[model samples]
Target chain A: MNKIIFLLTAVIVAAIIFFVPPIKGLGELAKIIFFHVPTAWVAVVAFFSSAFFAAKFLRTKNFSFDELSARAAKLGFVFVLLSTVSGAIFSKLTWGAYWNWDPRQTTIFVLILIYGAYLTLRAAVTDEKVRAKVSAVYSLLSVLTVPFLVFVLPRMYFSLHPSPINSSGVEMDSEVVIVLIAAVIDATLIFVRLMRR
Target chain B: MKLFGSRCDCVLAIVRKDFLLNLRRRATFAAMMMFALTATASLSLSTGGALLDEKFLAAILWVVIFFAAGAGLAGTFDDEAQAGTLPTLKLYGDAQAILFGKMSVAFLSLVALSTFILPIFLILFDVGVEKIFLLLATVLLGLIGLAAAGTLTAALTTSAAVKGGLFPILLFPVTLPIFLPAIRLTEISFTPAQVDSSLLVVILAFDAILILASSILYDYL
Candidate 1:
């Protein structure tokens, strides 16, 4: 919990850096890198955690693991919602629109809906074991599309979002490279802290 | 010979019992059909028939199919729950068989409902026969995926504290990928000259995978 607070504080401090005067407009796009990207990264982490716990629940037929999996899925859904909203806001500022139906936007929206269903499924079923097993199978099945939706499909199709600097097959300017790396590290630290709780 | 005869009789008895119950409660089917017709008609009217455009029409058709399927699958276990017969059914028959049987009936009903709506959609939207066939085929494949996924999730959530809104919420997202390909195929089918073979293959692959997973995991549910 303390670690989570510390990480969250770091996020706030990062936000302050972007929001405070001197660095505002030109840096606002970079601000999105901090919160929006982390939300997506954490959502992915939460999904994997849910899957892991789901598998464990099925293997051992343990209710605790089932509960853990359900909780992780719930968290994942929240992060997915956050990611979508933040990404939309960022898109509006950078691209002059809130909703573009870009491949990234569309695919992530679908993913969010999928995870939303995952939580709803847990809430609907009364029998604990049946819920766990069924949800486990679903979580696994849904994960199969994540790779395609997040990576392959988006790139194969048209998207307004910038391709990741490393993967776009283009050289990155020194400052942009530094900011991107910092953003990733900061997001990872936040995720690690959240997971500890 | 005597043992096999008894087992066969038992399976038939169970199926017959389920069928009779379904037939007697025509309310469920009637309500679903009415819902589909009303929703489709309202959509067709509200759009001033602009929804007749293949792209817009396909989207509306899919939305209707989705909700109709939800309405049908939502009640799949309701009768069992109301009659308190699920435990009895679970004990007397293979749970897998029961689930598959229910799904098969629901899928058929959805197909029938789609049959009614498809013609109306094509007529209202001015879609060609070729596009209609493509839309119908895509809807069928998509329904199979929906029914399979929906049945399992519905069964899981049937006993939950709040089953009403929860079922659709749970079913929709898991079925979104299936929806995309269905939409794509409908669009492609509208323009037969530009049909992508690979997209069709992907939809087929998705349907097979979801069906297999749903079937394998359904018994546990």
Candidate 2:
């Protein structure tokens, strides 16, 4: 099943890159949205799952839940790093600077920082039970602040980010939206498969 | 009524005990003050008293306080951990009361640290306080946020194997959201501009949330 899903995702990605038309003004560089946005989305999903598992661990005192939570966090951290690098490359091409401290940029940076701290914290403790409890508490704290960071803080700043979706409307081209949605679904599937492993 | 009174007394006793311990050692307090002073002196010496933009001064002041607090506040629970009293407290003491007592100590020390640092910061940097009351309000909220978040982080670090080294790594990122609004508020406090009351609300919200979270989560820790 994993192999089949992986192959299917690869094919869909190839189709996205080759068949989908470039955005009118953004040109081929807009293809990045398919990869970047979905990765970020997956990272957010993974983090919340990690927190969910952590909450479960705290309540049940089960080591298996702790293991699942740690795995989810690790996956989330990797996806966040991928999204950041992809976003930076896209930023460099379009905005003339790799990192402009845009609201989106700052938000991602903080996310990465928090994720890194979570992993470091997990590694620092020697005892398994203690580590699980400590990291669970930290994960709960992270989830509490993350919504404010991602949703509210960015709205306060004037961003150069092409916010294709917002409360106002979805301004994205239909083809681009299709490809982006497909990528997001594929990425989420990949995340689920990895978590099972 | 009896339970409430005894719980309050327990908290007070822990706070008083920690206060006396703090008074006797005085190292962390002096270190926080000295660190803040040294940072101010270095900034003063570097710019040679040249006039600085208010925004820059505000950032500098927060940077100093943030780092000083980061350097010093992580040790709030260190002595207890070292003396192996943490387990005893865990076994015999109310987790909530111990947390509150430790948080109270941290808050008091942060207040004292800011009090000592602010005057020198103003004199050395030649900052004319355009809104003294606003400055005080912002600083007070910032310190509360710091103390609330810092005490929780200190508790966390106390349990880790690499105690001292891991404190800032865990504390800094968790506290960034608090500092971002705080630096902006501090910058505005230096200007005559109408304060963005929202920033104060944000810090207040974070302080309350952190304290509440710490209280709930302290049980597991």
Candidate 3:
């Protein structure tokens, strides 16, 4: 618990130093970096949890693995929602509009719906063993698209979001890279602590 | 010979049983169709003048399609539960066949509902033949994607205590990727550029993946 509280404190400090100060004339738009990027990172982490436990459940046929997958899915849903809402708010500040139906926005919205369905599926079925098996299979199958949505589709088409890799496949900005890596670590530690409990 | 015969018999038996049950419980189908018609009609009446604008009409049509699919797909599992047929069906034959049969029925019901609503849509909205055909294809493909994914998810969630609320929450996120391209395709059907094949491919890949997953995993359920 002490370690967890310390880690939480570290996250708060990171948010204040890196996110609170305005840089590059981004002003309020920069605040979204703390929320949007971390939420997305955590969402991916949640999905990976589902995938890992799904494989375990399938192989061992253990109810515990299934339960873990379900819990991860619920967390994933919250993260997806957070990413969406924060992204939208940022878009409004930067683009002067709340919703542009951009491909990135559209795809994230769809992902949220899919996760919603996954949770619904868990609830709809009554039998414990059966629900676990079915949902595990679903988590594995649905996750196949995660790569395409997160990486391929955004780059293939023109998007408002900055592409991490340029046309020649180079990093867009070193500072952006540094901030994103730190944010991912911070968010993942928080997610682990939450899920562990 | 005996094994094959029993398997065939089981498949036919389950199919027949589902069909007969659906026929007897025609009210669900009727309600779905009526809901689709009413939704389409109300939109047309309210936005009669706006129908002249193809872009607006296309957007509204897709909204209609989504809601219509929702109304039809929502009840795919209700009758099975009420009649106490799910457990028996699970025990009788290949779970894949049952899922396929149910999905087929849902897809057909969606197509039928769309057929009724389409004509009304054409009359109310001055859409062109090329655009209409493209939009129709989009709707068909979108419904297939919906039914395939929605049925499996719905089946999974229906077992929960508060399924009424949980159903959409679980389903909407899973189906969101499919909707983006679908809505985009419908919106751009009138544009000179050919329909986006990549988006269609994405939807098809998703459908195939979900169907395979549902079939292989449904036996566990």
Reference-based TM-score of each model:
0.84, 0.95, 0.82
User: In candidate 1, what are the lDDT values of residues B1-221, reduced to their tens digit?
Assistant: 97656555555665576568768988777777777888888887787756356666667778888887777778778888888988898777666667666766667777778888778766776777566566667778888888777777667666677776777777776677677778777876777656655655666676677777766666555
Model 2 C-alpha lDDT per residue in residues B32-86, reported as the tens digit of each score: 8898999989989999989898878988988899888877888888888889988
Q: For every candidate, what share of the true interface contacts is present?
A: 0.54, 0.58, 0.50
Q: A30-115, model 2: which lDDT tens digit per residue?
A: 57878899899998898899999999999999989999999999999999999999999889878888898898888788778778
Residue range with the least summed lDDT across 10 consecutive positions in model 2 chain B: B168-177
Candidates by DockQ, descending order: 2, 1, 3
TM-score (second chain) of model 2: 0.94
CA shift at B84, candidate 1, in angstroms? 2.8
Q: Residues A24-120, candidate 3: write the lDDT tens digits.
A: 4567455676668889878877988988998899988888888888888899999999999998888887778888767688677767766776776
Best by DockQ: 2
For model 1, the local distance difference test gives: 0.72
List clashing residue pairs in candidate 2: none
TM-score of chain A of each: 0.79, 0.93, 0.83
Over B1-221, each residue of candidate 3 has an lDDT whose tens digit, in order, gives 98767766775776577568778878777877787778877876776556355566666776777666666676677777778978777787767767877777777777887788877876766566466677777888888877877777667655566655665565555665566677677767855557777777777777777677677766655
